[model samples]
Target: MNRKLWTLLIPVVILGLAALVYRQAPRFPQEGSAAVIFARDMRLHHAQAAELSLHLLERPVSKEVRLLAGDILVTQEAQIGQMGGWLDIWGLPFSGRQAPMAGMNRLSMGMATDAQVNSLDTLSPRQAEIQYLRLMIQHHRGGVLMAGQGLKSGVPQVEVLAQAIVNSQTAEISLMAGMLRQRGAAVAVGLPGGSMNGMPMKP
Candidate 1:
């Protein structure tokens, strides 16, 4: 009833209303948001990795290579589904208007070119295994980089998935490198150098 009390009460009422509105606000990634871009691009990236794994599986390869391919196929497919689900939840189209991996080099993304993909079909079993290993290693490197960018998006879901990709793929990269050495081959060169956690990519 007093003037001073009324002024303090008015401020408290305004603060309460603001807090209520904030709590009800919808939270989601916008079209141009980093999370959206990461989801869209990473889905395509995972699709390619899965397809490459399938190609390798169709051939007669070593047991180790066969098992690795199967793992990659399953993991990438699951991740693709996860990212696609996020896009749907955000009410975004599966694909975006911008070119895939926009603002980043395709090689940086470790994507196999049309020619490279076609080349797999022409290789003998042994040759296919070697080619697939090299390509997938490079591809994982690219995924690491993209996922690193995703981590910077400040979206909780994006950061969690991005970190998961970084951890799993980085470990897989090491495994595949060993596989390459066993075959007397080396990882393909000339790709960018960076880890998913903003560090230099490990050899």
Candidate 2:
């Protein structure tokens, strides 16, 4: 084929393949299925994680905290994009008609309240590191919880993503714990209802 003809055919071929894949993809989750709930709520939860990490990055903090903040920002932003893609592919709205985490037993997913979020701005550099570590520990644990729920979804892709969350966030939590101790702050206690094993009890 001529170069001009090849260029015209390339785009058409790509779109045709994409449409074929979409049609052959597994059946989409129903409105209240674990897949939909996890996608919607986890995206919101990850947005907060990325936002809080950005706040930490803007301040003068320890080298460890800065590195951790940058990692969180990048990682959670990617996760948010992945979950958003899932929602789009499934033909679901990004926000659900029911409340956030509605199918997940109304768990707040350990989100920081407005007061807690606002407090980051007023803290000293070292204090900010401590606070961010504490809040992120809670946030990550919440991710483990949500991801645990995803394991019951029976969707191979969703289960794989959830298991990855369980693995990665559990390790991050341990690292954050060590960092907190280095900063002379105790590790956060009373993590929401779960041991550090990343398995959440079903509500």
Candidate 3:
């Protein structure tokens, strides 16, 4: 009788332990959660920024621009890691079901098309610097928009990362604008509704 009671109690204890472990596991984000969306999209976005920075490093440019490119390369690559790690932790795929920027405003702001990115390989050093600076400034603006969206996520970790992107990129935008001015290149105009320094761009 004692043996029979012990067998039944063993299974009950095992079941309770399983339930406790499941309860303690981290919760995965929903498919459409802001954290998931930001992680997926921003990983791809930061990858592009990393590529552009590498291109700039290979080109002949002023020390100022080189320093800026170095900074972007390090910062964005780390951010890519952060976002990718979040996706892995959440058990989500690297790419999402939705199209890129499907739900975001100012869709064209930061992204460089394949053609634009590929063309950088063929440009002269001076031309590459100018083109890269122009494209990056635009890209940074788009990033700020996405990061702003991330800040609205209720998840504390996601909001912290998003806010960091906003602060860093906003300052970089001003820095890039100054770089463009030093080189006598025109600042890349923002999208119709987008603005530098948070003011709306004029038509």
Top lDDT hit: 1
What is the RMSD of candidate 2?
9.0
lDDT of 3 by residue, 1-203 (tens): 69999999999999999999999987877788888888877877888899988877887777878898899999989988888888888887787777656665534557877777876778987778788888888888888777865888777899999999988988888887887787898885675445646675321
By the lDDT metric, which is better: model 2 or model 3? 2
Best-to-worst order by lDDT is: 1, 2, 3
Ranking by TM-score: 1, 3, 2
lDDT of 1 by residue, 87-108 (tens): 8998999878886577767776
Residue-level lDDT of model 2, residues 80-168, one tens digit each, is: 89888988999899987776666443224767777777778889988998999998888887888778767998888888988988888
Top TM-score hit: 1
State every prediction's TM-score relative to the real structure: 0.83, 0.79, 0.80
- Ten residues in a row with the worst lDDT in model 3? 194-203
Per-candidate Cα lDDT values, in order, are: 0.85, 0.81, 0.79
Off by over 4 Å in 3: 1-25, 99-107, 192-203
